[model samples]
Target: MTMTRRYVQDLQDGETIEEVFLLVDKQLRANRNADLYLLATMRDKTGIINGLMWNVSEESMAQISAGDHVQIKGKVQLYQGSLQVIVTRITKVASDNLDPEDFQPTSSQNVSELLEQLKSRLLGIDDPQLRSLMECFLIDEDLMDSFSRAPAGVKAHHAYQGGLLEHVVRLMEMAWRIGDLYPEVDTNLLLAGVFLHDLGKVREMAFEGAFTYTDEGQLIGHLVIGVEMINEKVAEVEKLTNEPFPVETALRLKHLVLSHHGQYDYGSPKLPMTPEAIALHHLDNFDAKVHEFARSIEDDPNTDSHWTPFSPRLDRKLFKGAN
Candidate 1:
C-alpha cells in the first residue's frame, strides 16, 4: 500500500498519520492499571515525536526494537505542550524499503567545508609541541571520519549528524575573537583547548542508526575518555618528535578537557582551573545554550503563541519577539 508520509515537524494535533520513522527508542512499561503499553520515540530527518502504543501484546512489543525503521499508523495530539503520537498499528519495514536520509537529522552546514575550516584554523597554531599533538589526531583517517560525522551530544545540544564538527568550528571562531580581548589569554593554547574539548564525543555517541550512548559513553563519560585520548596522542607525538611533549602544556590541555563542563555536578571531574580552561567552559556553554534557545524558538509548534513554553534546561520561557 502506498502511504503518504508526514514529517514530524509538519504534524499537527488531530491529524492521522501513516509514516515510516526510525524507532529511535522504545520501552515497555506497565501503567497504574498494570496493563503494558509501548512507549517509543519515533524520528525522521526533521525531528522526533513521542509515541504511545496502548494494549500492546507481548509478541508485538518483542518484534520492534530501537533503531528499526517501522511504518506506523497514528494520530497526533498535544500532550503537556509537546506533540505525541498515539500509535494504533506498526510494522517493521525492511532495510531495503527505507532511505537512510529520511531518518538522520544533520547539520545544515557543509561537512567537508566545515572540516577544512577546522583544519586550517588548527594549522594556524605555531606552538611546535601543540601543533604536533594536534597533528596526531588530524592525520588519522578513521578518527577523522568519525569526528566528521559524530554528534556533539546525544540530546543536550548539537545532537544531529555532523554536529560535532559544527560545534567545534563555532567554538574555535568564538575562541579566536575572545582570546584577543584579553592579553592574559594564550591564543594558541585556547584554540587547541577548544578543538580538543569534545574530542571524546566521537566515541561517546553511536550514530550508525540513532544518536544513542555507547556502553563506554555511559560508563566512562566523555571527559575521562577525552583525557585518555589526549594522553595516547601525546605519547605518539612525543615518540614522533623524539622529544618529550612539554609536561605543563600537556597538563594544561588535559585540564581543559577535564573541566570543560565547568562544575563538578555538571560532570566535570575538576572545575576549570587554567585561564584557557575557564574560557573554554564559558565559550562552550555560550554556544550550546544559544543553539538550544534558537532551536527552541524554531521548533516550537505553537503558531499562535509569541513565547516558547518554559524550557526546563533554560528555566524560562523565551520570548519570540523582534525588539
Candidate 2:
C-alpha cells in the first residue's frame, strides 16, 4: 500500500503519520526500566522532528543509519512544548526508490543571482594583483558549483543548500559598508578575506544528502585548509604574472583567513592583528550569531509563548515579540 507522505512542517499534534523521511540522526538510549529505546531526528526539506522508538530491539536499531531515507509510521505529539514523533515502525527505503532532492533544504535566495552579486563585488577591487587572485577562484567553474551548493555549517548557521553563497554575499555587503566607515581598513584585502574565509568549507563538508563533516575536515579544520588553498592560488597568480606575488600582501590575506575566528581558543591559530583581519572577524561573527539567534526563534515550536526555550549555544532564551 502506498502511504500519503506528510512533510515535517505540515504535521499536526495527535495525527497518525506514515511517511518517508531522511534519518538525520539516530542513537540508542536506556529507559528508566533499563529497556533500550531509539532516539532519532527525522527530516524532510521543510524541517526536522524528534522521534522516539520505544522498546526498540538491537536488531531493529542496526537496520538503519543516519542519512538513510526510511518509511516510518508514527504518531505526532507534543513533548515539553515541542513536537515529537512516537515511532511505531521504521524500515529503510532502497536507494533506487529514494530521491535525495526531497530531503535537502535550500536557501530562499536564488543561487545564480547570489553568485552574480559575489562576482560583481569581487570585480570592484582596484588592486590588480588582488583582483587576479580573486579571478583565479571565480574562473574555476567546478569550485563555483561547489561553493554555490555548500552549506556554511552542519547546523549552526546558514546550514542549507546554497547557504555558503548567501552567507558570503551578506558578509561582503556588510564588510563594504564597514570599510566605508573606517577608511583605515584596506578594502581590497578585507573584501578578499571575506570571500576566502570559508572557501575551504566547500571541501570540508559533504552536502549530497545530509550535512556532515568530511574526514579531512575533522582532522585539519577549514582554517588550515583555506590557508593552503590561498597559497596554491597565489602560486598560480605568480606564474601567470611571471613574477612573485607580493609577500606582505599574501601574508595579510592569509592572516584574515587564519585569524577570522578572533582567538586561539575559538580556533584561530593567530589572533586578528590587522585592521582588515579585525573587521573581518567581527563582521563574520555578527552575521553568524545573528543568523543563529534568528533561526532559533523560527525553529522554536512553542506557539503559545513569547520567549523561546533556552538555546545552549546562546545560553539564554530569545524574546519573540509581536512588535
Please provide, for model 1 over 46-111, each residue's C-alpha lDDT reduced to its tens digit, 9 standing for 90 to 100.
998899999887887888888999888989998866799999998888989677998899999999
User: On a 0 to 100 scale, what is the lDDT of residue 308 in model 1?
Assistant: 81
Q: Which stretches of candidate 2 lie over 4 Å from their true place?
A: 1-4, 30-35, 95-99
Residue-wise C-alpha lDDT for candidate 2, range 1-323, written one tens digit per residue: 14455777788889998888888888999989999999988878878788999999888789899888888888999886568999999888886866676788899999999999999999999999899999998988999999999989887899899998999999999988887789999999988999999999988998887688889899999999999999999998888888888999999988999999999989999999999999999999999999999988887767678998776778888999864
lDDT against true structure, model 1: 0.89
Residue 140's lDDT in candidate 2: 87
Ten residues in sequence with the least summed lDDT for candidate 1: 1-10
